[model samples]
Target: MTVSRRAGLLSAFLLPSVLTATTATGAALAQEGKPREVVSTISSGYFDDYLMLAVDGKAKTLSGYYNDGKCRFIFRDALSPTELYQRSELGEAYVVDSWDPDHPDRHFTTTLYSKTPNGYRNQLTLEPGSRDENRPKACRNRISLDRSSWVSESFYDVAVVRKRGARVFTIARAGEKPTPAPRKDRLPPPGTGVWIDRTYSAAFSPKGFVRLNWYDPPGTPHGGYVRQEDLYPSQPLPQRDGGDEAVQ
Candidate 1:
């Protein structure tokens, strides 16, 4: 697959109008005052870009990766009680509210964090069609905590030509030329899900590039590269009985 082709397929599937309903559903889910099981949170670079992995008791796990230390976190319970989730190390605290009344999802709308001047602020909002527009769609983008790594499961859309469809695509890269990876001769249909385990990099890259290991359902895994923009980085909860070191 080439960059041009991937963009074309993404654009074709992203018919705005067609995906509007799906996006709305995710926003709606973020609001419900449901109780969520604590997963894990990983923060980097002044806490601007961070990943929170949580579950709803059921198998459903939601991993949210927000850049600039700001993004809506649809949690079942408030992590703090004093109106702000404060971080003494960063000298900043976060506030929460339901800005979108119509699309309210028990989650805070826009960004609700500020650095204390205690009055200095880093005003940021997650408005519709904003910079965060490229975010992954809920349900379509699933996050999981596998052992110690925060894994993201999503499908790749292969475009169909006159008669045949594409199986491989040239993945996009950050601040560099795209790289082509080996692929299977036969590819699943456009909607077939090709799950990937997101590889993390502590090294900061504005492009949000990540290593994606392709999984054949219950089989082995393959390797690939992708940008972490739409996807969020997640930290796994503290180890259970096994007591393994979590990946950073």
Candidate 2:
């Protein structure tokens, strides 16, 4: 998108009613206390000017909402209602580049803390670009999907194993049988590869499967899963100064 066009779009999005709560009461209502139970309902949107990852009809993850009213919350795993609030805090400090607003496809670099044998620790990711500038798109293909579509431009770099050993991996979609080695040229091809040095979020398995939502290469950005042994414990990344990687 052009600079001027991008600015106009951002201006429209930044308007109080669209991006945040204009009045204290609106903010207060949006920031209302968490729901009392795990009701299985999950929602996404602005609550009191803060973007939130809502659960059980309540706002669990909170932050400044942006990106054309669509904030993508990567589901790391299922947690108690209380633990959800604690993890959502990671999005509070997300600082995007001034020019990032131009590219609607980009997502903020989040600070992920994954569980490991030693305990929880921070992981690193590429810092988000400016909100006002054009940056390289995370999803190479520009195919547009609905806000609720499975396709995503960003990903959560989680691990299923640690550095203690190595294993071959066959990246497969959820419910699909694992193929030996699909092809290296494709995105997340089913292949046998060793763990790379990096840090990601904790493993979350619901329904007895390790799940993730991301942009499926050569197609839409959506959610998929792999075997538990496929992931690894990653090294931590240095924290950035400011950014709000909010949940949807």
Candidate 3:
């Protein structure tokens, strides 16, 4: 999409109704209060925003979601109503509910916890068949026959695996971006975008995973929505002063 066209789309998305949550009451309601484990009900709000992963050698994918609010969660092979939740401070965060928004039959459970100066721990117990060694993986293609559509354009990187005979074809993004045309283009070539390293494994199966993550910025591209400066004058996207890669 052209720069001007991309801007218009973003502007429409950033409409007042689509604004991010910030109310103290609502946030606190969604906050992790102590630790609890039991059959629970979740809101579609949890899995709303996410990152995608594809396993080139397998028949699954790893899907992740984050709350613009203290939590980010990822789910492997949508196995059951049981889900796993992870939390981090200082960035967009929120809890992820496992129930499907469109289909009420599917669900998952997760234990909530807090990591302070003391140590890391889980506050809840396993639900029925939940595995002891908690990790990440994509769901069986059963739930989302169209995993491609379930994810956003920026999340195309999640589909690393293609069915040997059951091919899950994706709308390969636009061709290689020779360059960031005019800074207002609507999309990035499938290969270009913010990338992170991750290993996704399927549930109840032998542990199998590979590291590499790919992602693109949301919306058409950088141009009609005004700069982040104009919208949130109170806070700005952080500027990293310095950083270094650590040995794994």
Candidate 4:
């Protein structure tokens, strides 16, 4: 899709009213200090991602199931009622990315899910995460299902470098000049791949720039800003053998 078109769609999706309603609901639930359950389903063509969140206000815990068509992953985390409300207001929380070292293909760092007026929406993270040896062996399990009945477009947030000689800015302002990022930080040439957090993109869209992270050749993570015009949405590219290679 064209950048303009995508921007328009994103603007509508991130309307202030939608975010406010979600925050208000979460706040009310926390105030009640009672147990509650929230179920969210995202249909994407033949695959559907399902999540069921059960919050125990008194116990200060949150547990849920995250089904990604291929596997049913169990998620359990300790979070106070106040923290739960705060996380909901922020529109994201930490979830197990990967538990098995044998399956590198399934690795991911962050998981984004939020309640919206229509339903809950999730953005699949393409960036891989380190294997967690502490996680239980049962954290991931295969599932079989007929997915033909599901039908909806899936959107993954990936950013492709669209301009050459693009420099990373430690800080970016709409009208002000941008300050160059530290010399240690760098971005691959145009056509290389990167990704951004949807929440950050939406929050900074009005300013015409978004902050993102990229790894140096040695795999060190660095954060900086780039002009929104320098990027276009695209699917993640395949990683080369050996450790994670920045999409080239």
The TM-score, computed over Cα atoms with residue i paired to residue i, of candidate 2 is 0.21
What is the descending TM-score order?
4, 1, 2, 3
Query: Model 2 scores what on Cα lDDT?
Result: 0.30
The sequence of per-residue lDDT tens digits that candidate 4 reaches over residues 1-248 is: 99999999999988987889999999998889864443334333221324333344443433333444443333333432111334455233333333222233444432334344433233322112325444334434222223232221211223456687676765445455444333444567754444343333443443666666544442455556677787643223333355322221
Candidate 3 Cα errors over 4 Å, as ranges:
1-47, 50-58, 77-217, 220-248
Pick out the ten consecutive residues of candidate 3 with the lowest summed lDDT: 224-233
Off by over 4 Å in 1: 1-166, 169-178, 181-187, 199-211, 226-248
Full-model lDDT for every candidate: 0.31, 0.30, 0.26, 0.42
Summed backbone clashes in each candidate are 10, 35, 29, 0
Candidate with top lDDT is 4
Return the TM-score for each candidate structure: 0.22, 0.21, 0.20, 0.27
| Candidate with better lDDT, 1 vs 2 | 1
Better of 1 and 3 by lDDT: 1
* lDDT, residue 113, model 2: 25
2 or 4, which is superior by TM-score?
4
Of 2 and 3, the candidate ahead on lDDT is 2
